[model samples]
Target: MSSLTLGFIPLTDCAALVAAEAKGFFAGEGLDVTLSREASWATIRDKVTVGALDAAHMLAPMALAATAGAGGPVAPMIAPLALAVNGAGVTLSNRLSQALPAGAESLQEIAAGLAAFIGQRRAAGEPPLTFAVVFTYSMHNYALRYWLAEAGVDLDRDVRLVVTPPPRMVEQLRTGQVDGVCVGAPWNTVATRGGLGRVALRTSQFWPGGPDKVLGARAEFADDDRLAPLLRALVRAQAWCDVADNRDELAVLLAQPEYVGAAAEAIRPALGEELIFHREGACVPRLEHAQWFLTQMRRWKQVDGDLDAQALIASVYRPALALEALGTTGLGAPVLGNPAPLFDGTTFDAG
Candidate 1:
């Protein structure tokens, strides 16, 4: 049995992969897996492309971007399983949030005000407002772009997009190097708790049930014999993490210095903390949150050219494997195409 090398970035959502290995899920399947933490998404994609990694904990859109050959090193990546979802938010520096009209009453209102604020800053001769995202192909980047464009602001013109790792987002905002950021959990919680930033909007608000992260591998790897058991192990891990009680233990495991490399205290809050949009209050995590991400991918043209959107999503998500591993045929449903009409008045079909 060849050892499987997996790559991941150090973010809270990488918990499932870390816990699966730590809790013996992978070993149980007679596989030796090495989890390597990469510095950036580009490195992760490159390593996977060249076969340096057997699989990876990848951003949903990053995986799509690789398959689509958009703005990154070309690679044939496929996501046959989802690792986690709905763990991201948009964080604005306290100074910026405070300046918004009505002090963050509603996302649409704040977005409008943010556009106006950027205009005022430009008129005053200040540098264009800069926002940081973990990666260009990440859902965070697309979500930020979506919200800004909705407010009539142009991302390329109204602001500069900078790539900042999740762990550094809080400190970067606190020190005034950037105006705001869109990143995954623990970072968002850390920013708010430290009084440096506030949640302007969660990914959920932008599109409920958006896809966040997925277990990705080279397309050739998915066709290999090793894929089934590997995906089965991941399915079991996902089920274990979904249980409310198991989340705390999973959080502790993810917080280990060898895993996320963050203090346990920092990582724990992000796992169970209800969705808290500093101004909108808290709510439970929902599966619908993952769907929104897929919608954004379509909106951003991340899903390769002229491919059937439904087939593209179905090709990547293996609900059958997830169900088989969990021993529940109906436990999960495949999010291949738009199931129902969207609030934004967009319809996706299997063209």
Candidate 2:
């Protein structure tokens, strides 16, 4: 088989793809994969659109947005599998964290505090609060919007949302260019550890089983019979990474220069249980997170109207393929159904 080249941003969620290639998971499945570290999500999306990349670790909503041509540079993209879920957080600057009312806990409280902060800042002639997120189509943006809206804060008028890369988020917060940021793991932990910020809310709190990252490929590439095995190899890699026993090893692997490029110590806090949240305390992983991400796509109009979004998401995540590759048919129940209240305010029976 020809070696497949995949693109991924240097983030903890990119680990499965990187590990699949490094640990020979792909080779064991009769595939050779080259993992390329992309500089930005836009670059990764463009490369996949133009076929420069066979596959990539993509933002779930971004993949759907590309397919639907909703925004950004239009391209045909599809995810044949989900990679990770609910590993993102909304981090507030240290000042913001300290200003919350006593016993203010949970996203609702943080949102309330943020509203008050914005008011106080404005009353004192300070500038409006500026916030950052990785991408406009990302769940981080949607989740942040949802959380803020729930608190009766108008996202469009009450605050400013800017596009800042994940790597730069902590620095941006530290420098005070932004008051808060919603981004994936390690960055949030990094900000907290550096005493620059505190996690106001974890993505898991808003949408418990939210989709985080996915294995995306060009539509034509996905349709190609030759590439099916490569997709299968990725599914196997996800399963391998999903095992609790492998978490420690995966954390070490992600710390390598070629992967996340962060210190192992920095990456460790995010890989284990006791997921830190400024509002709610740490919690365990929930299997339904991917479904929550799909719901976010629907909420933000990222999915094409022509497709049944839920079904499309289900098809993309091929647990059966992973099971086949792992030769283990019994690995716990399959993740199914809407994990939280649907963004559309509708409900469906999983059966």
Candidate 3:
């Protein structure tokens, strides 16, 4: 049996990692796995980059950033499997409700309200509204940027974008330090349930079927002989996570002190329908899906012309390896990964 350690942040999407350990999937694969809980995404990325952790539950885009040397230290990483998608929601301060237009049903309406607020603040000479995302290269940041930009809110001038850890998102809202936050799962639920904020938009509303979290590791670690067994264990746990009947039980498991540490009820916000581990073409990491994150990184000026997005995506997303791993376990089918659709009607093809 082999021994290894994995790191994860306290987000519900870490379920795949947690499930593998709790359900003995790793042990079944003849591996001894130790799960370490980290304080932030940076810690997870750094630990994995430095070989302190064998692998990690990582943000899909952050893995791209780490590989491309876009926003942080340059470390070659690979994501063999996507863990979850569309598990994030945007929460706004209650004070924004007063600013919303009557009958604000769709995201467009809510965004219009924010536009008006931005205009009013500009006219009053007040400082721009501040919003926070978990990291610079995160789905949360892009989702929030797209939402605000769609409504003509200048991302730089009309609003200030900051990075805040997911665990502290609700507290930031309660303290009025940030006007809104785009955070994952339980954090958004915690804010709304505790009356600290209101959910203005679910990420799925504008961008469904997008990659959220991924199984991340340095290129060297990802290529190790142990990767096949790790993938086998994680794939089984992912299938377990995809089943609707397992959600209730999984929520309780994730809320353990060693995992997410939030209440089961809080974590439930992202279970079942909103979160995906293996199903919906999530089991295989796709270069096409990775393309979207890199595109966003370029759109935000995080990376420049020197970076080849396609080459970077290929270096980091090993779908062939994932498929081979699944084959070793007799998982039957091979998947190219479902090409994700964009809310803006942009066509996406794996080719």
**The candidate that achieves the highest TM-score relative to the unseen native structure:** 3
Worst 10 residues of 2 by lDDT: 276-285
Better of 1 and 2 by lDDT: 1
- Write candidate 3's Cα lDDT for 140-208 as tens digits: 888788778878998889999888989998889999999999999889888888988788888777667
TM-scores of all candidate predictions against the true structure: 0.84, 0.83, 0.95
lDDT of 1 by residue, 1-351 (tens): 548999998888787678668888788878888999888888888888899999998887777667766776557677766676567888889888888987556777888899999989878988888899999778788778877887889666779999988888888998999989999877887788888888888866665545567777888886677777776676666656666787778767877767776666767766655322111111111223334445566666665546554554555555555545444423344334432332244433221
lDDT string, candidate 2, 1-351, tens digits? 567888988777776787678778688767767789888888888888888988888887777677656666657666655667668889989777888888888667778887887778778988778899999778788778877766777666778999987888888998899989999977888888898988888866665555667778876765566455765565556667666777778778988887887777777766644222111201112224445555655665565445565555454444444334333423333534445653334332121
The stretch of ten residues in a row with the least summed lDDT in candidate 3 is 342-351
Give lDDT: candidate 1, residue 277: 17
Best by lDDT: 3
Arrange candidates by TM-score, highest first: which order? Answer: 3, 1, 2
Q: What's model 1's overall lDDT?
A: 0.71
C-alpha lDDT of all candidate models, in order: 0.71, 0.69, 0.84
Candidate 3 residues lying further than 4 Å off, grouped into runs, are 334-340, 348-351
Clash number for candidate 1:
12
